[model samples]
Target: MSTVYLVGAGPGDPGMLTLKAKEVIETCDVMIYDYLANADFLKWCKEDCEILYVGKKGGDHTLPQDKINELIIEKARTGKTICRLKGGDPYVFGRGGEEAEELVEAGIDFEVVPGITAGVAAPAYAGIPVTHRDHTTSVCFITGHEDPTKEKSGHNWSVYGQSNSTLVFYMGVKNLPMIAENLMKNGRAADTPVALVRWGTRCEQTSMVSTLENVAEDAAERGFKAPSIIVVGGVCSLHDKLGWFEKKPLLGQGVVVTRAREQASGMVKTMRDLGACVYEFPTISINPLENADEVEEHALQLGRWDWVIFTSVNGVKHFWQHLRNAGLDARQFGGINVAAIGPATANALRDRGINPDFVPKKYVAEHVVKGLLDLDIAGKKVLIPRARVAREILPAELTRAKCDVKVLPVYETTLAEESGAEIEKALEEGRIQYVTFTSSSTVENFFQLVKAEKVQDCPHVKMACIGPVTAKTLRDYGLTPDIQPEDYTIPGLVQSILDDK
Candidate 1:
């Protein structure tokens, strides 16, 4: 039998999309989505899959209810994998119940994949628990919009009003006046706590708190728009203390970090935990060097060298790959001393069970050179296998110390793919609140990926350069840096963004 999967598109963030939802979306042949469904979530769909926009936006309806229903049935009949994706929980405010009923009447096989509803999701994102043991004992889910053509009169507010349950209304902004007045008329207190959450669970989310009698007016004053939720009852009063999303360490700060993907992973995890959303735009993509015949041929000659130095993790990785290619392993360095430029590179070597004998306390190339000079290398042989763009100071200093040093280029740097559309769309829609540039190369390469034509039109999205070099690059690109760290490290850049606030 044919199937129509009615899946819920969780509120805004693609991260909130369930693993099951993501898996099905990846395999679906065709996906029908609403305007409110997060577009980023659709990126999970197979590249060749057809996407159909079937819901209304603002006052314009792309495809009416009847047309959308017919489309789903027709697609299912074709034996294609059809997905009717909706924003939030389908059965909640989404006319999903009506659509499912229609499908059942027509003898169509349909299944609903529940999603995180906006009413519950919004409050949770704001760090307010919908149910609290000390406050609300029960919660009532209600609608804000009622059928206009339905025969006359207000809903029986008394039934829910007297229950003392926390009432949450979905799509209730437009009819707030009538709903509030009717509730108060029945038995609900005018002073009942109410909250309006707009763009819930998203970076742009905003909220306002007031009493039942004046919530509508207060929401309007705060400019709450559609795709919002109205929650009522005592639980609303606890938001002031429970609001935690806004309290993240790097909540509104934006920093740019330029490090290789492998090296950048640790820094990214650290920044994210501190409440900062890091935008990864790698300036220099690392690629293996063109010719390594000489480096590979001299692999066992490592014992002839007094020291084998690695400047970056890429250096360690590429050198190791070459060693394996030549049927050599960590044991080849038996009599040779090992050195790494920093702790990160040292850990990379240590992971291979070959701990470096020495590593610079500081991470810079100059520091590595200074530290090596402190060690006795007179009349000794040293091997430095690193990136083509890596500094020559280490080898030069070793030579100055009367040591024979061989510099082998292990990897090369290249620019990453263009991100013009992403940056442009993010700026136009205000999706990206901040951007971090970790290196001068990243600052230049990111702009190269972005169309300069659109940059001038972008609104006030904050820009942060990780260091002076990156800051100068941004200035050359006709953009002024908002935050620059005194130190050129990932944590330093992150701290700079936080310090700005």
Candidate 2:
């Protein structure tokens, strides 16, 4: 028999997703997710997993409540594990109880996985703790969208207004006036602090603060829309002093990363951690060389080379892959001196128990050639394992030093097939503040996707290049990079952006 797991997706932040929720999503055979849930979480699902969108937002119902319940029951009967992914805590205004009741009635087994509700998390991200000891000890979560014309109101405004507790309302922006009026009429102070957090917990989170008396008017003037959380209490006043998320240097800034998807994670994390809304636009995709025979053949004869050079981390990785495939290990290159172009490439070599003998201070072809020249490679046999297409300056310069240079193409880079719509839209809307290029290929491919003619559409979008080579590529397209780190690495690029801010 298959079991149904009703999992909570947490507020809007993908990081808030529980480990259990991720595990369930990875193992589930089918998933029915809500619209409010961050779709990024779906990446955890198996490629062949059956997914259903039963999300309901306002009146835009993808599937009615009754129909969703039936769908869950029917999917569970297929003897496959089903995941009902809901936004926020499963039982907290998610109608998870209703679904559970139906499953029980149908004699189906089910498990509930609670998640972080938006009420608590949204306020915390906005820097207002729900339960500050100096402020209020009690906190209440309420739905502001409750029907006002119902015969019997579901909430007791009289009790809530008199209680010394923080009040948090979900989906409350539209009914702000009525909610404030009812609270004041029931003895709540009109001067009480109120804050509305929009798109809370995500990169675009913003909060507006006001008193109960004029919060509705303030929100209207600011054009605060739905999908916002309203917090009413003394805790709302603490936001200014405690607001940390929005204070990040790149908090509201949108950045586009043009590295390959597999290599973009580190840069993406760095930018996101600094509070920038990062959009990954992989312009170049890395693939292993079609024929690894040369790489494998050279790996077996590694002892013949006096110096082995790696220009990029991908070179180190692909080289090791082929070396391992040929039943060779680091021992094969025991006497061979290793030279890495940069710290990242050197670190990649070190990770596999090979410490590079030379890592140039500057990560460029000229620096690599200059550093190798100082190492007396005059009569040496140098083996360079790198991408299929790269600057020939390193090998040409090394060969001029009387060294026998042998180049092995271990990997290749190709332009990504898909043009990223999200990145293009963000750029067109002038929402993207920075466009990062990690390599010459990335710069070329990115310009191909976002034509040079349209580059003027986003005049405010600054260019960031990882190194001088990438910056030169941008210059070739009639664009000058605004941010270029002195260190020429991902961390350096991120620090340069932060330093500029």
Candidate 3:
């Protein structure tokens, strides 16, 4: 906790993480985070960093405030950098100010990093602006329930009720009746518009609207709990008209994305955009090939081949790395035609100073072969720079066509490790609704870590494969894919899942 960084984990989306917060997280020696902090942030920590969970949810505190403060002081004495991460803004009813006072009393150096709080963000996500020129000019933020440890309450209902302002209450679900009564008794209108938004900014975000006179009763009937933001004003009336939340087909659904780690970010965002809680489980780890000299030697003799085929971006990247290491560039390819399996691979080739001569509409072995053979490569020498263990259909087909084909290994995919027990627990707890496979390797590697019976036992959990090839791999393991797109692409796969739901 030496020079502790009191950082804020923004309202739900990992994409909202600040540049400085990301830098601190990546370099911090210890991460003292809470439940509201995105679990994805943990993956950014260094392998050797120590992590402590001090989550406080509803009345369930994993570690009490006294113990957490003591733990931070103890760790700070060791001169290790500590990231004291909290949900939303540390100063926005998050008890961050209290913690900072304690740190100051202990003479610990600290820095505060602000975040997007639920107060402002939740209303916006629900299509209710806290301030409107026609409605109110000012806004008031109050804790629905004050600290019980205090000798007296700090709320002045008389002045607050008399003011013409928007009222927002944090953690107000349980105290909604008391708050409504206090405001009404102090001269505020009982029939004012009010909205309750729970788990704001997340895929599980839900909101209900009513007047202050009836919101509490309605919330009780609906069983809305704490951790909800209560917005009371004319702005609440805008929710029904401006909100598009109901259109999200995958809302509150949990999706597990299994792909190579480096390639899964965009996929994760896409799944979340569909209003699903994404669990990024990167089953495959892409690394350089063990045979560096073999790849380098092949790079020096590219002129011997009539065509060079790159099946994936990894192939293009790894092959180009060796080509540069051998003091050769794309200009060295004097007479060799370049072929890419998909647009992504073609883009990767173009990034490295080579424009692919041929790219198929469908990214499959058969389609690639059909497109290449259309260009008349009979009896030609072909070199494929690709994964160490890949489907041999392309090479085998060319060999059958009386062409010399050499499959050169450029990169390899290995299994990435995570807590299998935790994953099983998430599935058992009904937090996971879908498991996605983007490639054959991802499907194979996922089964290697997770038991087939665990997946089979969860009737609610559906398997989603990107295309027919990946689905075939899942079928080989005796599991049928519940969702597969006819277009055989990432966007199409996601759309198919939404359509199925």
Candidate 4:
């Protein structure tokens, strides 16, 4: 059955997204979203899903409201599941009701999924609770700017001023001065506390506190614009004591990740949680080798090999799947010893019910090769599962130690085909503060997508490489690494970026 789900995409932070919202988004056939919805949510969409942006910003409407309703109706009739993603509550300030009514009249099956409205969430993130027990008991949400085409104003300033309840105004920056005047005229105290939160709950969030009497003039001097929330109440006084999100150390800093799409999720989430504006520019794609059957063939002879070494996380993953394809499990590896180069690779081995017999202290080739050489497995048959193209140090060192090392190409890493416009624009404008490269492949492929000259043009955009090897690859491109951690891992790389700041 075809259904249209009206989904609330939360205010701005992607973490505020509800589990149900994520479920519907990933499974939907078409996702029709607007400017208010966070772009980060698009990553949750499954492959082959259709994404259409009808985002309306200021007076620039990508598609008229009536046309959006018609599009939803037309998509529903075509038997395709549709997800109408709106920012905050779908029913808050937009044409959500009109669209719902249109869907009802069209006899389309639909469901309404609620989201965290900005009025509540923005205030909370700003450290100003809209309804504190010490302040007003009631709260009201109002649109600061109404329809420009309306002949008459429907608002009663008297009721609003005398209500003595906390008032939150959406899209009210431009009309804040007038709103403040009207509230004071209608028996509201001129000294009432007011807070203007711009881009609330986001990395670029900024808050300004002022009294009702001088707020308008102060806003004019400070240059506050629309897309801000106007909180009017005694509750706003707590902003100085309670504001936390804006205090984040990395807030508003832009960092780009050039890892493969499959492996960048954890790194991306960590940067976002620290209040850095993260851009995922995946530069490579990991695919199984064409001779994938060779992995299964090699798994069958696991009993003959004295040792097995998995070099990368991708190596561990693909090798295990092919091992399973051969109808063999971890038990088949019975007496063969395993070695993993890094903790992540070791954990991947552990997940498949095989803990590595040896894991080096450092992920570098010298440390890993030395640790295995110290095991005194000279002349032993060692099967190494890794990418088709990788550093030869491990195997070369093993061979020198008289160990018979045979490399099994389990996976291939190829440059991904993706547009470089976003990253180019960010670098050109000096907006991106850092570009994080997790591997030599990411560094090499990143330059393939974004020109070296463009990076040279933006000296402010420093390179944060995970390890010395990746740093050397970046240096080959004529760019020096500004951040390289002593420990070669994602958490270590993130700490180095923080320390660099």
Specify the highest-TM-score model's number: 4
Cα RMSD to native, each candidate? 4.1, 1.9, 1.8, 1.6
Query: Per-residue lDDT tens digits of candidate 3, residues 1-501?
Result: 378888988877677778888998999999998888777788999999999999877689999988888888778778999888888888898788888888899999989988888888888889899999989999999899798899988999998788878999998788899999998999889889999988888888889999979988999998888678999888998998878754578989999988887888888888888789888788899999766999999898889999999999889999989988899998877788999887778999899888889988898888888788899876799999999999999999888878899999998888997656767888999999999998999988888888888998998899999888999999998888899888777788888888888
Error of 1 at 388 (Å): 4.8
Against the reference, the lDDT scores of all candidates come to 0.77, 0.90, 0.87, 0.90
Residue range 413-456, candidate 2, lDDT tens digits: 99998675667777787788998888888988987887776666
lDDT over C-alpha atoms for residue 484 of model 1: 80
Candidate 4 local Cα displacement, residue 166, angstroms = 0.9
Task: Report the C-alpha lDDT of model 1 over 1-501, residue by residue, as the tens digit.
Answer: 677888898887556888778877988999999988887667578889889998656446799888988888888888888788899888888889988988898788888989998878898777567889987888878878776778974566888677678788887888888778877888889999888888787655677789989987887787787878888888888888888766676653443445656567777667656655455556568888788887797785777888888877888999999999899999998978899866667889999889898887666556667777778756688888887775466777778878888888877878764355656675676556567776666676777777655656655667777666668778888888888877666677777767867
Question: With candidate 1 superimposed using the best TM-score fit, by how many Å does residue 89's alpha carbon deviate from the native?
Answer: 2.8
**What is the Cα-based TM-score of model 3?**
0.95
lDDT of 4 by residue, 372-469 (tens): 77897777999999999999998898898888889999989999989888999988877799999999989989888899999988878889999999
| TM-score per candidate | 0.81, 0.95, 0.95, 0.96
Q: Count the clashes in each prediction.
A: 5, 0, 0, 0
Point out the worst 10-residue segment of candidate 1 by lDDT.
251-260
Better of 2 and 3 by lDDT: 2
Off by over 4 Å in 3: none
For TM-score, candidate 1 versus 2, the one ahead is 2
Instruction: Give Cα distance to truth, residue 339, candidate 2, Å.
Output: 0.6
